[model samples]
Target: MNKTERLLAIVMELQRSKLQTADELAEVLGVSVRTIYRDMMALSEAGVPIIGETGLGYSLMEGYFLPPISFTVDEAVSLLLGTEFIEKRFDPTFRKSARSSRRKIEAILSRPIREETDRIQGSIRLLQKDEMVLMMREKVNLGIIREAMTEDKKLRFTYHKRVAEADGNRVTVRTVSPYGLAHDEQNGWLLLASCDLREDIRHFRVSRMSDLTVTEDTFQTPDNFDLQAYRPKDTRSTQVCAIFNPEIADKVEEANSYYMETAESKEDGYHVTFRVREPEELLSWILGWGADVVVTEPESFINRVREEIGKMKEHY
Candidate 1:
């Protein structure tokens, strides 16, 4: 590692432990006592909390924290996997942040930890197409939205939304407080905000927003504004069953925790059941699975699928 990397790593190691003697730090870092003193001075100059006494070595202050670190084997693997996923699956700005975070992590670890991160990164397979153009645009939009969210500022924008029919002209809306940003499988980016005129939780497509401006007028977020409540929940109380081919079963099982109890091994495939809140959401998921899954129950859902197929055929 370079000098800067070594210094950063030393600081991280020292921060993780209680007060250590200069001798201890020097021994761990494989450097002489004089070199340790030099490093300590450099750290202190860099605004690092390296307090020490004549006999006692040094310790980081309580409030002092490193950017973020992964020490455990599992944690290292998880970080690598999560970073890889973000880089592959998220829009451009998110991917850049993920890469930057990963670099910061690697700069602080020892050789062994670095090797572990490398191994995990190399072994993990994120099977998704890289949407570079979308990623880049989304990254810029996300940054602006995130800043506005943190500053608790009102936003002004010309938002376009379909009125009555899918082919209808877009309606322009002037909105206010943006509560949060959420991801929709079919919709891409959805901005959860309170419409100034309607005064309700309204979802707006981020891609459709134009002439966006962050206003100085700040607004209060609802105390009861729970993201969990806003998120799509299982609407169907009745159990709906489906059979998943082996290829898709493994992927589906890994993606959702609720399936653990419902998945059963069949002679040729895996049988699964779950409560679905929206048939549309479930249908989208089923379509993504292609021929790997078969819907077996809830005749209404099956009928809805047929109706959708008819509509699709009409379009074709």
Candidate 2:
């Protein structure tokens, strides 16, 4: 059990009993006496009114109880939304715990509040397909990646890079010190880490990787490693324009860059303008759309695409 669950359990145990010794509490909770002592200290710090005597043991202060916590309408709705997202987005342990917690929250909510929350939930929805599927279908274990990140350990994986050529992708083995995970609007969950092969920071699409294994070796994050700084930035941003297939109009909005204004639709499809990232990155995205999309402005971007296509043809 995690610290949160243990703390809740401790409170419940105390509420039901008159007085409990540290040894008795430790035995019942399946934790060490030292842990119980630490928990008691923590509870006291949180103003739990846990009174202890030299010989008598521990008990709640007479007539004192753990106070009821309350949430405002917006706060409750926001929590429900988060719970729903976690239950849908995550798998296994995370999903299970979130489901249980959601149920607990629902049980405590007043009827009127619960009804409003239900209405809000019904109105909001996320998809497993479209953009989400690109990241959701991870051939690798997410838990393993999480463990590696948490332990600050090294990871070795066979990464499949999405190649432009008809010959398909090039697979390579990479061993890197795990730094953090980033979820890109276009790419899904990306592992941002120090790459030993490249001798620099690189982001790998977690869904595009396979044969992941955590190493016993530990690593220290660089002192200068700031995620915001690690991403390349240009003083002047590129104005990227593209047309999406009307069938996947939602995806146009999904791919909107941070600097992009709202996507506008013509009769054909959604017209997207992104004050986008570097030229190379934008080119890759346009190519990924294949025949379904086309770039309009920036004659320079059009020429680069033509050049890249020629190279791809040469490769084949």
> Cα RMSD (Å) between model 2 and the true structure?
10.4
lDDT score of residue 6 within candidate 2? 80
Once fitted onto the true fold, the runs of candidate 2 whose alpha carbons sit more than 4 angstroms away are: 1-67, 130-136, 164-169, 226-316
- Candidate 2 lDDT over 1-316, as tens digits, reads 8877787767756654658889988887789989989999998998888988888788877665443555566787788788877666554567777876775566455556657777877887766544355334542356678789889899999888755323443788899998877766566677888889888777888887788899998999989888766774343367877787888887766766555655887898888886754555567777887878888868888888989889989989
- For candidate 2, what is the TM-score? 0.57
lDDT of 1 at 87: 70
Q: Write the per-residue lDDT of candidate 1 for residues 1-316, one digit (tens) a residue.
A: 6679768867776654557787876776678888888888999999997887777668887666665544776776687678876776555677777975665565455556667767867876756434664544454566677778889998888776533323454566576798988876656677888888666667777767777788898988989888757863333555677888877677988767332338888887888887643444466666677677778878888787778678877998
Task: Provide the overall lDDT of each model, using Cα atoms, as 2-decimal numbers.
Answer: 0.70, 0.74
Model 1 TM-score is: 0.50
TM-score winner = 2
Q: Pick out the ten consecutive residues of candidate 1 with the lowest summed lDDT.
A: 161-170
Looking at model 1, the pairs that clash are 91-135, 92-135, 235-277
TM-score of each: 0.50, 0.57
